[model samples]
Target: MAARKKWYSQGLRFSCTGCGYCCSGRPGYVYVNDEEIAQISQYLGLETAEFLSRFTRETHRERSLNERPNGDCVFLDPISRSCRIYPLRPRQCRTFPFWNSNLRRPRDWEDVCRTCPGCGKGPVFSYETIEELRRVIDL
Candidate 1:
């Protein structure tokens, strides 16, 4: 019989280095569900409707946070490279590189790690832990 492979059998570690590399570069959507929008709105002390209108935009049937003209996220502070709503950031933002797409293959993760200093460099996550984080991605 062969031993089964665990989710992160190779062992993965990650910690944000605060370089803000993930928050900028290339235009992308940060999808936020209604509950997330409400949390963020409460964090910012705004009503749900106001927060949605002021900080997000609709695309087809989905809603995502707006971005600066240069592609940086609206919540990212350019000068300090810090998220204004760090605690209440969207689910996608909270999950970081743990998204299934990046974890699907070793090469894919390496590709993402190239610029993200935090990807391969911090606390090692157990398979269970990694799976939990992956599960919440876009949820």
Candidate 2:
């Protein structure tokens, strides 16, 4: 008997090598939602309002996570090359190259892929995971 092909085998694949390159330097906007904000605040042991005031900035009327003066994410631990708030990270961070709503064209992903070696190659995610991301981001 032949095994059924995975959804990823039809199309789409990505594996995060955990290089941390994508989490470094001023790359692009990292949008956050209210629920995510609350989760991160709780994770940091801070009040939701306090966390937002301390770690986020308003841009174009939207709240975005703050970046360090050197351009890295505020939550990025330089020594570990990992996100201190990984578990509570926002949906934007959760959904990367698979941001279907923002990925209207291949060019939209070029810059991201250029900075992230993990892009365009890696693990094959199930369609369920992709759909979950879409739901999380309201895409």
Candidate 3:
């Protein structure tokens, strides 16, 4: 009989080297759920309504954080590629290669992996960590 395959058994790995490449330039759309919105708004010392109005845009009934004119995320500090609201960043940012349906495809990761220095090699996190990330993002 064949051994069962784990979710991430493909041996994919990554560690944020702080390159900020992911946060730079035009960051793609980042979805924000109600809980994430509340957490981030509270972290910024604002009411949810105010934060939503000032920092977010509505699209087809979903909410997304506003991006800069250049398309980078508003919370992304261009110079540092670091999140201004790191403590309150949405679960999407925290999960990276483990979030949503994107990373499920190995081929899809290649384009991103090619540009990120930390893609193919980095510190190995335990399976527990990956599972935790999944939980945080509600994946």
Candidate 4:
């Protein structure tokens, strides 16, 4: 049988406005793998162990970036409202609004659009691209 088409099969537009909405005002995990951790550590000029100790916390046997007391991502600059480590941000951070959770239904995408200003702006991402990104992380 043929596969079912998704609500966003045509595509969706998104371009990060650097608004920081996805990085703050909520308690969530920004998971990082070993390679990402290493890259971020080197980018910050810190040893891997030091970076892990200072910037990450273990939860459910996985490593996640630490959040500020108010639930803002640690890398989010409160004054600038931009990511401090954008160059080497984790896969989870890089795949915003394309996660499985957000693409599961039209309603879910709408909710994402409400919270993320970039959701319906900029270049259109094809279904193939969305599926590739959605497979990167479950979210």
Identify the candidate with maximal TM-score.
4
**Model 4 weakest lDDT span, ten residues long:** 88-97
Q: Using TM-score as the measure, what is the rank order of every candidate, best first?
A: 4, 1, 3, 2
Error of 1 at 132 (Å): 0.7
Off by over 4 Å in 4: none
In terms of TM-score, how similar is model 3 to the real structure? 0.79
Cα lDDT tens digits, model 1, 1-139, are 9987854676698998888887888988889898999889999999998998899999765898999999999999999999999988888888888888888778878988998989889889777777888899643
Runs off by more than 4 Å, candidate 1: 1-7
**Residue 95 lDDT (model 1):** 82
TM-score of each: 0.90, 0.76, 0.79, 0.96
Query: Between the candidate structures 1 and 2, which one is better when assessed by TM-score?
Result: 1
For model 3, the run of ten residues with the poorest summed lDDT: 99-108
Tens-place lDDT digits, model 2, residues 1-139: 9976533444456788777776777556688877888889989999988998999988775788998877888889989889999887787777776776534555755656777787778776666776566566643
**Model 3, span 1-139: residue lDDT tens:** 9976655654567888877676666656777999989989988899999999999998765788899888788888888778888887776777876664545666656767888788768877566676677676643
RMSD of each: 2.2, 5.4, 2.8, 1.0
Writing each residue's lDDT as its tens digit, candidate 4 over 1-139 gives 9988888999999999989999999898999999999999999999999999999999995899999999999999989989999988899888998998998888999999998899999999999999999999888
Q: After superposition, which runs of candidate 3 have C-alpha atoms over 4 Å from their true positions?
A: 1-7, 126-139
Query: Which lDDT value does model 3 have at 99?
Result: 62
Clashes of each: 0, 3, 0, 0
Once fitted onto the true fold, the runs of candidate 2 whose alpha carbons sit more than 4 angstroms away are: 1-9, 107-111, 126-135
In model 4, state the lDDT of residue 8. 92
